[model samples]
Target: MYCFMSTIDPGPPPQLIQLILSYLKDGQSTTEFDLRVMPLAQDGSTRRYFRVYSTNKDSFIAVDAHKTGGDPKTLSAPNQNQTFHYLACHLLERGFPVPRILQHSSDFNFYLLCDLGEVTLCSKVLENGHKNKKSTLELYQKALDLLFKLQTEALINFEHSWCYAGSVYDRNLILENELNYFLKAFVKGYLKLTVSPKSESRLQAEFQSLADEALLAPGDFFLYRDFQSKNLMLKDKMLYLIDFQGARSGPFYYDLASLLNDPYTQLLQTQREQLLSYYYKQLCNRYPKSAPDNDTFTFFFHLYSLVRTLQTLGAFAFLTRQGRKHFQSYMAPALENFHHYLARLSSSLKLDTLVELSHRLYEQNLNVKKRSP
Candidate 1:
């Protein structure tokens, strides 16, 4: 359906284009077929994506993840590009559904991948048909099932250095990336709230306390840092995870919270609780020896849900301020998610400052609101 009349914007570099053209040509003349590159809509990250259309092949997904002229010689602190290359390769070998890496040029800073098609779990969720829910719920559960498999099975010969955003989800990452991100971007920047020195100290202590509790979860499973619907590509009636460059070793609850608390789908609290119970049962079934009991697991699940809520809000606010206006729409729903987890944990937990802030955000109806960033 994408028609190119005349304008052909030169995408990527000459060498990268040659690689793609050569691969697609498959021994034929490059001039014998039409080749076009079209930009794809991207999320909050700096990486750019494109779909390369060719007359001969099914098409390829091209990624511009970094600026040219720097190849990562070491795995330590590898950029998103290196992480994608190694992780995608490893996952593919493990029989996961990651897009096939066809070709990559380190000097040109480009990667050509098998196109995974246009369907995302978010599109399936937002459709109008009621039958979509019946089927979508099954798919959502399947996604959870995949999450569990990835968390457990993929660790056979995993290397910690493949993690681009640090090797584990520790107190420092929680404080700086999640908690402090919420404070700086969502509270202070977006909501325009000024924090007093005393309140700031109290908040820091509360964040540290939260980090401690989150670390208490049993089993260092793989945590897909952004496990929401939009990050899942639905193909062949199955869910395939994307945007996993931030994957690292961490607690089980964080990812469950990410999928359940996702604002893009806006799942009801009851549904979230049901799914949480489903995932918990799986945990018990698999790790009967090491699993936390029902009560303990529920407590930690809600705790991680609250942390995930904060991180989501922070990303929403910060990205929206940076001119990604669509994220504004999800702000209200994310605020509701914050309220949802806060209420669930109200009996066993109480962070008064966060509670107050949630109330304020709702009062504003997140006046600057929008979707999952």
Candidate 2:
């Protein structure tokens, strides 16, 4: 017998439920398994997931990727679902926490995954209410360790035949284009500001430099593009990576930024720096003969962190306005942090001008919100 407990009503869309039942009946006959769809928090992405369960049997998870909404070519240029499938299977073989693949219906855009359970790092931290700073830090450290291991051990060369090389949305392009998400959506779109030509020039120069710095990779590592507080699942005190469809090859620093500088959880500056140092040390310790030196690591960390921060600013606004998701409260403090960090990093007049323009727009938005009934 299987038992299901959901944070939300039902499990998934009616069609998906029917598909699962039909597939199970057609393919295998074990004891009846109960499906659970727990409402885990989601980010801007359209991907949806649920937890699965069965009595005295291994539990699992499921994903309804129906909203990905396109052919493989349209999704990301080259369309490499096979690579993701292979990588998941390979990683699972190596004792990673990815839910085991029980079944997949490519036509329906859904997959049944081994449930990794309901607890996440975010839920635990929030439950403890931030006063348990040490525990929070430790959880973050464990996550980073898992990430570092994945990059160094599991991701190297793992058969690149399915590589999406034709995709124009590589690191350089992703960084360059995604900056507009911040500039247009967050700065101009959400804040709704007008700036002098001088200010605009500065903003462009600032973003351009940051993009250039971030485009360099620390050897190609499989980037879980949306690795953050939400996509991580904690089961039996271990962290597991979920929502990995956006996985790709990029700088190792990419995941680090997504984790440490997450908008939902603004870890204090001192704590963040210490975590960075710890991450750097772990990387060096693991591949002592192969890893980059401390100075190089610091440069990449700062560079990629800025890129991620800007990308997140745009995602927050776009997700709220277009996707109908409410993430404004989470983004406010993150924007403030971005402004301060920009002030410290950018010395050019053009860059400073852009920062000032963004600031003006941000202030005005706050005023508007205050006056709105």
Candidate 3:
């Protein structure tokens, strides 16, 4: 979980260090500062981060992300550094709570951002042992309120180029890329199962249907592709959003699904419903005439939840395959959520092969857990 990557070939790269120091000094000479740099815990991304400390106790997060050839399948932007910087400034102007981008390399391969501290919503939930339902509900309500703002208010006259996935969250992005990512990463790689040609056909059809249903949801709002607790930072008891480079104009229900069904938080079914109802009320209050009816919203919620579940499982499987111990910890819970959503849709969605494979994987996971000791 703690990964330290040297910023330079030898010691801390002097140029990068000086760049950060100059920014801290407000474009003045960098010679007057004493600085300390330490690696922070790594997340699911390949980007390397360091917490830079100053003698005056000022701190900033330094990110080093090398440029790479683009992959269409990735949820991250092809140029995440630039995308993050642009979006941060854009959202800040709109009164959204996001880290400030202090400075950046001309190419945007590296940057310094306001340090938001170490406590994440996910960590806070775990710290509570997920037992304090009342407190947890309050936290989620706060998150939901922030999400509403992100999806609505900040989106006024939004520019599409600020998003990594362009302006729109289209059906191809949902079905072909995200669903197929699940097929490749979780089904084939992790589960180690081969689907017959007929089953593969059926799976594709089911995924397509889900995407079509999601696309019909009633709003062209901003969708934070990863709106879960882990990407949410809490500093001074105020929620700050991060890792939003993948945001795009999409159905609002997708974000709602992402938050409520997040495996990291593992909110109980009743709790999930309460939060969903709360979000619906807020949505209606905000856009009374435009907000979809409860039945329509519920339909897209399930559809998007299923897609989000698959996407999470795929990421977990891919990360685990790459030997990332941090993501490995989430695999069991993700599988449980996978089963939970699949079961809920069994009567409505025709995904027999995927269902069977998921059940098999669940049993296999349970057996592994039993034998772990």
Candidate 4:
């Protein structure tokens, strides 16, 4: 069972809550009363969210984003709340569906924002109980359409004011950092598997090739790093972006893999392909100059999908080991997606060599577990 979270009476402690009430009063006179705090979901991140109920009126979301929540110094650069504010302002101005920023306190590391209420894309799909094929495909197409619109109209001239914001998302960084997650935690710590010097050299060579494909990607649009179903909420037939702390100027395919092949809500293979084609058609309608043909987009799609799958494997392992979370449910599905790439690339000498070494490590770990008292 999941751990029980604490409740806040009336609202969060006086100072911040008081400030929120003050801001609400300044904007509009509503019902004339104090705000009440109600705890909401605190995911694996350091941030905690709350629903603020006004006396006999509607409720708004109060984001208490202290650096000390779980990850230390979260308010430092690339903080979730700060990125949300930046994207919210930018997207909303361009007529995209996003939550209205009521007010923000950078010093306190909290924000009083217009609540989106409780209806994420994942919840809506699950609430339907049975996975209706038609509905799922339609929903994904809708999501893809929004993404296409954002990439074309809104993200074209996106400027990076902050220092870290302008930095290119190197593929080497993605592979090197995420590879450490599985190598250090799962293989070394949990499974107690050691890599020989020869194996390490072969693994590095395979990763170098994969990173080349990922890094060669064009930095076209503003990539919302975690643009999965969990971070997407539906409101009035539109998708709203959330949890955009890691937003960066990166490849077009980054957000594409995040949405279509998300472990949280698995879209069928047919649906995934259909949605990709739909996005390609819609996106090409705008930029006819550098539009990719059918075959070219397919190649890029598969390559990005492979990169995303590897990144997710490492991320889920980190969450399970370090965060003490149950992410085994996601492991199999992620591996299934990863296996597609492995099957195609099996003929490659470096890939085959690395897979052989990795399988040996897995076998050794299983044997160690069996022999343990």
Compare the candidates by TM-score and give the number of the best one: 1
Clashing pairs in 4: none
In terms of lDDT, which candidate is strongest?
Answer: 1
- Lowest summed lDDT over 10 consecutive residues: which window, candidate 3? 364-373
Would you give me the overall lDDT of model 4?
Answer: 0.67
Better of 2 and 4 by lDDT: 2
Q: State TM-scores per candidate.
A: 0.91, 0.81, 0.89, 0.83
lDDT of 2: 0.67
* lDDT score for residue 73 of model 1: 71
Cα lDDT tens digits, model 1, 1-373, are 2233235544565666667766776767555777778777777876667888977888788877665225677433677777777788788888877888888875436778888788888888778343456676777789899988988877667788887678788888999999899999988888787888887887787788788877777647877789889888988887787888788888878888899888888876666777888888898899789788888888888898889989998998898888888888887788777787788876665577667666776775656543333
Tally clashing residue pairs in candidate 4.
0
Error of 1 at 58 (Å): 1.6
Taking the tens digit of each residue's C-alpha lDDT, what string does model 4 give over 1-373?
Answer: 1111345433365555765667757757463765456678665665667777765446778777765332325435544455556667777888877778777674536777777778888877666543587777777787787776665566654556432343456765666655555556555655566788887777777777777766766776767767788788887767787776566677788789878888777766877878888888876887688877776676677777766777787776666666535565676677667666565555542476557744664454443222221
- CA error at residue 241 for candidate 1, angstroms: 1.9
**Candidate 3 deviant stretches above 4 angstroms:** 1-15, 25-30, 68-78, 363-373
Candidate 4 has what TM-score? 0.83
Per-model lDDT:
0.78, 0.67, 0.78, 0.67
lDDT score for residue 229 of model 2: 85
